[model samples]
Target: MTSAIRPPAAVLLPGTGSDEVFVRAVFGGPLAALGLPLTTPKPLPGAAVVDGFLAELDRLADQYGTLLVGGISFGAHLAAEWAVANPGRCAGLLAALPAWNGEPGPAPAALAATLTADLVAEKGVDAAIAQAEAGSPPWLAAELSRAWRGHGDGLAAGLRVAARRPAPELALLRGLDVPAGIGACTDDPIHPAAVARAWAGALPRGEYGETTLAAMGTDPESLGRATVLAYLRALTAEPVREGPLEGI
Candidate 1:
């Protein structure tokens, strides 16, 4: 009997200081339901650590013959960077809550990583959660607090790495012909709508949408599934003549 044909593989990169568990709960669950060949979500190795995360991606590309790259926040930024570097082998890019596409400032992830780690170390998870919840939607604060507790050390390390992460240059993403789907939020302080607009203005194929941490946690599976569907469709489909990033 012939084996069943699998769908193309997707590489998921989590936000800074995040691990597979949180990413899976928030992003992977939905993408997996689509029946795509999904690889395990992985953290991008820090420069200091020098783990061969990029090399693994290269291997996956060779083994699968094609790949779709998707990420959240810092993950999204990295995905864009990788897509720019490897346009031919990449199937597409799914960038969620992309931060600082071309802005000149510290990368949000670096700031978040350091601050989150500091909060965790000083106030403990419960206190940190409470503090964050003071301003953030309850659901997001809760989910992230849980993540903070579970991944404090890694978060600290990632913060250190992020603090040094340079702002992503436009040249890295400009003129790339590959299709891309970008998800943004209306209320996220870190993920400004203007940033999304800028990204839409630059990529060859870019679609913009909205999401929130509270909404995401309320129905992570549904949110992730919808996002993956949108991303996959964008990946296989042709670019729309007037997408968000058309003029750029």
Candidate 2:
């Protein structure tokens, strides 16, 4: 009897202003169940965050050799960019809540990040959190409040940096040889599902999956399970052409 091949270890990065705790909550259990140990790194401050994450990825790659890498929202964009730059060094990619592709422009996620930064800068964290909580869903409000508070004054600078950073170009995405799973939230304006669909369509080996931010908020494990399942399916299938695919 043959033993199963173990999947590569996975490293999951959190969204902007979020810490490792949040990512662990969302991805830890499901990935662990799949026999893949998960690593969630706490982000750095300001313009250093992306650079810091890439450096961490490099360190992990040197240690593990072509491991699975993934992230949520802005973190997802960073992961994609790194994967594109370091081809053959990624076992697979799990992009959850991809905010935009290529140039940042007027993408809702960037705009919202900028606006939230301004609010935090002008009105202070407490006031900003109160206003954001009043307008946001309970889950989002809670997450933001904690993240914002944890980030403190540095949150504004980090948000500004994230707002301006470019996403991985579609042409680059089209060149990826590794399997990819894109997890999208159907009703999330800041992290539009259409962006995720476009990403799946662009990748040479990609599959798409849908779950709402609300659903993820209620059950963080849902995002992890959806993405892992989609990635597993993509690994078994032929490299998909650029087009719409049935959601996972």
Candidate 3:
């Protein structure tokens, strides 16, 4: 934790249909415990959601000399995308619940988001939220209820944006060349743990940990700790010999 290596702050993003409130609930205490400041950007409304989140990360990187960026699900994908594009600006990465590696295609989270978007367009936010809540975990249902309402008229557009956005490619991830810690909810059907594991395995210097949505519902910090601990592990792991990770 030398001053030279420690980042000034962590910029965390929330997932589709989620907001800064949830990000705070999950990462606030854990980041605070690390004596690290946390910035949870509010998701932008409408079709430009993905671009807007990436812009927010860019802004934070400019504000601080180096950034430790992270997010949940869709948010995690965006964070990694930015890291891949701006490896020099990234100090490290702390990603949780990555939904997919590249073009979303038929990924469960992407499909769910797209379906919810279409539902919102047809039935309105209230009805769409009700339908989405039907079979979801109570905590998840309650979260969508609150967050979807917060998005209001723009909810559908935002959902569509996330559903269609492409994540960083595996080649881009392999070239990111930054310490990364990935976390996953092993039981999360929408955001599979295997996705997180793949992301961790792709990076030249990365580590991963797992928790469950059930545990996350009871203790939001469970996800945060899993992510941050993995980050610490990646950070402290012996440095790999200097070279391009092109073929790693």
Candidate 4:
């Protein structure tokens, strides 16, 4: 994010049981405006979820050099985890709806995923999907239906694995000197706004912004803009170094 350098491409990821379509809806336009081409890699369901994402991130970073990485919820967690391990290869972050700081613990989002996984196991995907859609907002209901069905038979296992996976630790976050922009839905019980602020505070150069599930239900771009604009501010405010910012 220095004057001499910016990531050549961005790879945004989707949350558990979500898909590239949702990732595109949330981040594609904003990144396009910034002249950053976007790529959304689909998650491999079940225990392979984390490793699958890391492998694709490795491929993209190797192909494009430094990468601008970001995502929603577990997707955000995966992006941060990659940045922690590959700081030199990462240009910046645009994390939206971070569910927890480190381990899942009793985080609402994790619990929700765990319960849904159990439900799917007991009642099957179709029945679980029906129960989920009953009172959800029309937009959310539609999204849930599409994404859950899309996960197919792998849905339960994917949820279980993702629910158990830990996000990048705050100690790890402190080491990433890139522009770390964190976003949260203020009204989302699953992803707390405070957790987003904590992530922002943990990084050396970080910014935080707020959107809402209501806004997300209507326009996914509202979530994108909230996160990306914060990233822009962090980028602008970051001090340019005498040497390439590529090396940590």
C-alpha lDDT values of all predictions = 0.63, 0.85, 0.86, 0.88
Predicted candidate 3 versus true structure: per-residue lDDT over 117-210, tens digit per residue = 9989999999987886898888888988999999999999998889988998877899988889899998999998998999999998889988
Which pairs clash (backbone N, Cα, C closer than 3 Å) in model 4?
none
> Where does candidate 1 clash, by residue pair?
30-225, 200-244, 200-245
lDDT of 4 by residue, 1-248 (tens): 65866546889899988888898988888788777889999888776878899999999999988899999999999999999999999999999999998889999999999999999999899998898889688888888899998888899999988999899899999999999779989999888999999999999989997889999888888888778878877888954331442121
**Residues 135-219, model 1: lDDT tens digits:** 7777676667765565545555655655555435666666667667777766677767667656756776665656665566576
TM-score of each: 0.77, 0.92, 0.92, 0.92
Model 3 segments beyond 4 Å from truth? 1-6, 238-248
User: Which of 3 and 4 is the better model by lDDT?
Assistant: 4
Any runs in candidate 2 off by more than 4 Å, and if so which? 1-6, 238-248
- Top candidate by lDDT: 4
**Reference-based TM-score, model 3:** 0.92
- lDDT per residue (tens digit) for residues 66-147 in model 2: 8799999998999999899888789999988899999999999999889988988898889889998999999878988898
Worst 10-residue lDDT window, candidate 2 = 239-248
Q: How accurate locally is residue 23 in candidate 1, as Cα lDDT from 0 to 100?
A: 58
lDDT for 151 in candidate 4 is 88
